[model samples]
Target: MTVNNIAATFLLGGIALSTQAQADFLRDGKATLGLKNFYFNNDSREGAAKPSKTEEWAQGFMLDYKSGYTDGVFGFGVDALGLLGVTLDGGKGRSVGSTMIPVGSDDRPVSQWGRLGLTGKVKVSRTELRYGTLLPRLPVLVANDGRLLPQTFEGGQVVSRELANVTFNGGRIEHATGRGSTDRTGLAAVGGQRESNQFNFAGADWRVSRDLLAQYYYGHLEDYYSQQFFGLVHTLEFSNDQSLKTDLRYFRTESSGKNSSGAAGYRISGYTKEGDGEIDNRTWSAAFIYSIGSHGVTAGYQSVSDGSNFTQLNQGGLEGKGAGGASLYLYTDRLTQSFTRAGERTAFGQYAYDFTALGVPGLKASMMYLRGDNIKTVSGDRLKEWERDFSLDYVVQSGALKGVGLGWRNGKSHSQAARNQDQNRVFLSYSIALF
Candidate 1:
């Protein structure tokens, strides 16, 4: 059945049956649409000639509908999401890279594009089953939300919260769509394009204590990649006026499906065996942040051991896989020019302060820096790059724009192998809950 048909049927079933009994079975279901008047621009220090800069403005819309479940031992419900993008200004010289919207077969950008996704949900107590469109964020597999739009998946999922402090989730994703697309395609890891669909994953997160937690995740992409992760987070109090926080993360990845060289061409670059073959990637990182009132400081280090580059779906900077939106720990997934990959080592530090300590209610500022060395490059010397990020955020405490939020981002990236990059982004966002 079509996506619209399935979603419409579920919506009707819930409403029609409730109406027959004169009961408000679906009392709180409503449709919501949003518009983000977004402006984005990126420039590389290399100058003209080469494609170093991109700029655009567009209105992104997301129409979502959620329904109340039927009352019973087994409850049933459905949800639908409609995404659309309209270009306010974009053409040959004006259009940037793959930021706002994807280019079309015509060679230039399309006036607009959209997609429709529907999901059927079944619930039994705290355990829920969802089939159809999926958005996953487990360690091994994370959906991309880095563009004016978000990338999604097509699959089945089972999420259970049987334990009060523990959440268990597992799923199989067969297809994926880029943040800028509606059409679903087979699954593939970052920089992996051998056409291996089935992606299997399972994970559990335990809230060990009020301020401490642990997580374990495992994932496999048919013939492309296999990954596992372990993570820990904790916050410790030292005194009435001081505290220390730690966030530790680690991952081990190997070759799977087609990339195993069972049939497909020599697995894409650097993914072979540990040093001479394909697939042997392991990475770990730790970050510590200490906050005392409005003044906070943080430091982190990350290392990767693999011939091939580490990969993950990033929703910032770059719109593709393995990109980081904002990160100082080296693994930051900014999709900008390219995902940071290959022989790599990184160290970073950040500091943030709350204006409330300074007597200002809704003002905050932070700055961070990350430096990476020994990055793998096909050319000669290992690649080297670093970035510095500064952010200022403000919110109106009272009045019409009370909950409105404004954010600013400025960054610069320099690479020893490629051109330098500079970027600036300003975002204005607000949300209203209509009951």
Candidate 2:
């Protein structure tokens, strides 16, 4: 059945529940409206591309409503999401490839666009089952939210926390809607042109101790690839505000189904060891962070095996214009680039401070730098690249503007393997609660 039909069915079921059950559901519900104004700009320094620059301004709205589960052995609930985007400005010839704004057949930014989503859920004991629109943050599948509206998936997922210190998750995803587009499309890897309708994943996180946690996840994309991930996080506290955190992650991926058979449409993109599109990679990274009072410092290193670029569920190769944005659970997934090229090694560092310590509440700043070298190329050449990013944020803590947020981000990248560029983004946001 369609998602709308399912939502209507759930609503009808709720209407037939006992009066006390209905009261519990209505009493615990919540609703909110979020507003965001964003501006984006990018300048390409060393590319022959048509649009050497892209600049745009837009406004976004998100209306969210979530109902509580009824009081019963098996309770039911529903969630609805509404998203709308309005274009405030689009620099005529400079807005061609703006991934955050939707374009029309005239190759111009659209005046407005929007979409709606609904999810129906059920709960029993410590386990819950949800179907329809979902924004998952699992190790294997993370929903991207770097643009005006978040990328969403249509699927069913189950989460269980019945066992102490452990949480289990399993899901099957069928479709995805890109952040900048209103239409939904099938799933695919970064470079694959054809669609893979079935993506299955399962994972678990175990709290081994008060200071350490362990995680394992497995994912399979039919006719594409299969991947496994292992992670560990530990924190050592020296005092209340002084501590050290260690994070380690590893991923193993291999070609499967049509990809393994060397099919034409299922091949991945980017540099591969054998110049073939088949996926085979092992990636690992380690990071350490130290914090004392309001200051924080982080250092990390990452290495990608010599087979192919690290594989992930990226739909950038699809036929649509805005179907090209993805996120990775890696420290090197920075603002302008993701250091995941084949045979690449990256080292990165960052420093941050909380301004509240200086008597300026609700303000913070951070800067980060990353250098990557030994990137594989089809011409048998190694390349190097570097990036620096800066961010500043503030929130109103008093008066009529309390809870309003403002942020600015800037980054510069120089690369031997890709274009050299500079980018900036400014955003303002606020949320209003409705009972």
Candidate 3:
């Protein structure tokens, strides 16, 4: 069915329920509205060939509504989301690409744009089945929310937690809408042209102990590749309000279907073997963090095999379809570079502090640095890169403006194989609850 038809059916079904169902829905319904004022700027240190910088300012509004399940052994619920973005300041030269706003035919940012999403759900005991819109955060698939609006998916999902300390998830995603655009596009790997309509995933999380957790997940993109992930997390407490945390993650992936032999022009964009484009890779990382009071220190290392760059659902090649940006599920995925090139190894460290420990609440600051080397480029050259980032955030602690937030971020990246760049962002946000 068409998207419009599906939306209409969900709405009509809710309205046609019994009077008792309607009363319960209204009684348990909840709504919220959020406001965000954002400014983004990026400076490319490359030669005059590229634009010197990109700067834009915009405002966004988000309205969310969730209704309670109707009365019965098997209950039903409905959820809706409304998103709107207004261009406050952006010129043709500054908005050449669709970085934070959709670009029009004239190669300029549009004045405004918006979209609506709806989800229908049914629940029994501790399990729920949902259809339509989704913002999923599983081990294998995470929704992107770095721009003015969040990326959403069209899919059906089932989540169950019938067993104590264990949760299971399964889903099939068909399409995705970019964070900066209003159009929905099929899924593909980064730099790939062919679009695939099927992205199936399943996963489970088990809390082995109060301070330890384990996870396993699998994902398959038809005509592309399949992947498996395993993760473990543990925390230990010490005296004097000090604690240590450890995180380990691993992923194994291989080509499937058309990508196995590179038929129908189904080839990944990055470095691959000479014969045919195939996915063969193993990536892993381990991180350790120590905290004392409100201060945290973290250290981590990550490695990617020599076969291919780590693969993930990316739509960057679909720029003509209004989808340009993508994100990876790795700590090395930073503001500038992902550090996932073939045969790459990365070491990173971070320091963070919360002002609450110093008698000032609602204020936080952090700094991070990463260095990567031994990258295998398509030209058969070894490359290296490094990045440094800093951020500060503050939120209103009390009074009428409580919960209002202000944030600032700065980053610098230098690479031997790519252009060097500096980026900055400033944003203000506020949220209000509505019945």
Candidate 4:
């Protein structure tokens, strides 16, 4: 072990101390069970033939249990998550595929695939330490939560919120067993073929004021890649129900470990600078949103350098997962990457509104469009493409049958660089509390 490993171990101990410093006492917890009905369809915009059956159905349950620590200088707690997914319908002929449930032989959707996760934690003043399981969303690394159930990791985390309005988080993840796959694997670059066993990260986010926030993050994966990121977010309020929101993001990354040692990561094989392979990249995005009463509009632009594409904490590729809706978080940039090429730029816009302005208390809708260009592939091909997304949603606001929500989403894409995808989705969810 190196000095860094020793420091990480100490950090983990500190997390345990923050919570365990207090006296012992029983804590309170709550449990909720929700039922969701969903549907997904995708048409192949590219390929020799027309799109076929790409749809599926299932019933799922989520159970959560959390324990609080006793009052004192230190405390301890435990948490557990129980998940169950059952295939209500869908055969080989109609199965679209998904991560929550696996597909069987002949491309048939499975009857079910469920797993449980448990965690142990300790807390001290303004800081907490946890081990066992993790589902994270950070700048350099985060869990994917786009599917029916979120992907999870196994490791330890140290988080501190001691400063007023400023939070610091750091961790060393030793093992990652993907939620979608039954196997556990080491860390690897999105485009690299080699694997690694450790991923180290430290980050901070600060709310400078009521309208402004800033973030700084750094991450290093053993024998893989290293990255640095900075971001600024602000929300400006204007006239009646009108506001302007802005987000500025930037990243600097390069090959590392074995890549730096030669023949690893996305670095060109057998090519080394002073006996070390190297792949450097820089990317940034800026977005602005304006909202007035019932109408909201947004515009954004993102660009990626030609050296190497941006990377994400992907467990299992989304191939098996059926796509039906646009994800709001975690996996934000899906437009351009290594597999799709590089030196890319994307411009996008959205318009949305609330139905309450027209007397419909529980309804809303939005539409978005994105176009990407200047994509450079390894074969020296420049590719261009675009996509449009539309979504509508409503929730019950009153009466005995309140708290139910329904959603519809439609998307279309076209490209000269890769396979085009046309998709649609339907989702219905209800939340019930048993007190």
Q: Candidate 3: worst 10 consecutive residues by lDDT?
A: 2-11
Candidate 1's displacement at residue 357, Å, is 2.9
TM-score of each: 0.87, 0.98, 0.97, 0.83
| Count of clashing residue pairs in every prediction | 21, 0, 0, 8
Question: Please, what are the lDDT tens digits per residue for candidate 2 over residues 176-295?
Answer: 888888878899999899999899999999999999999999999999999999999999999999999999999999999999987988999888877779899999999999999999
> Which predicted model would earn the best lDDT?
2
Q: Please provide, for model 3 over 415-435, each residue's C-alpha lDDT reduced to its tens digit, 9 standing for 90 to 100.
A: 976679999999999999999
lDDT of 4 by residue, 253-345 (tens): 787766665663434322222333365667888889999999999898888777655554443332333311212121134422122235778
List runs of model 1 lying over 4 Å from the truth. Answer: 1-9, 12-25, 47-50, 94-97, 239-241, 262-266, 269-277, 313-331, 334-340
lDDT of each residue in 1-435, candidate 1, tens digit only: 644465567666666654522243456456776555566777876845545567766778877777667776777788887788887766765554355666666546677877888888778999998887777777777666656667777788999998899999998887666665545566555444455557788999999998899999888877666888899999999887688999999888777656666444325454333343356677888899998988899998888774567754322322233222322223455434333466678888889998987778899999888888877766654678887878888988899779777777787778775678877777666654432
Query: What range of 10 consecutive residues in model 1 has the weakest lDDT sum?
Result: 321-330
- A best-first ranking of the candidates according to their TM-score comes to 2, 3, 1, 4
Error of 2 at 2 (Å): 2.6
What does the lDDT come to for candidate 3?
A: 0.87
Q: Model 3: clashing residue pairs?
A: none
TM-score of 3: 0.97
Best by TM-score: 2
For model 2 the local lDDT of residue 114 reads 90
Clashes in predicted model 3: 0
* lDDT to native, each model: 0.69, 0.90, 0.87, 0.66
Candidate 3: stretches off by over 4 Å: 47-49
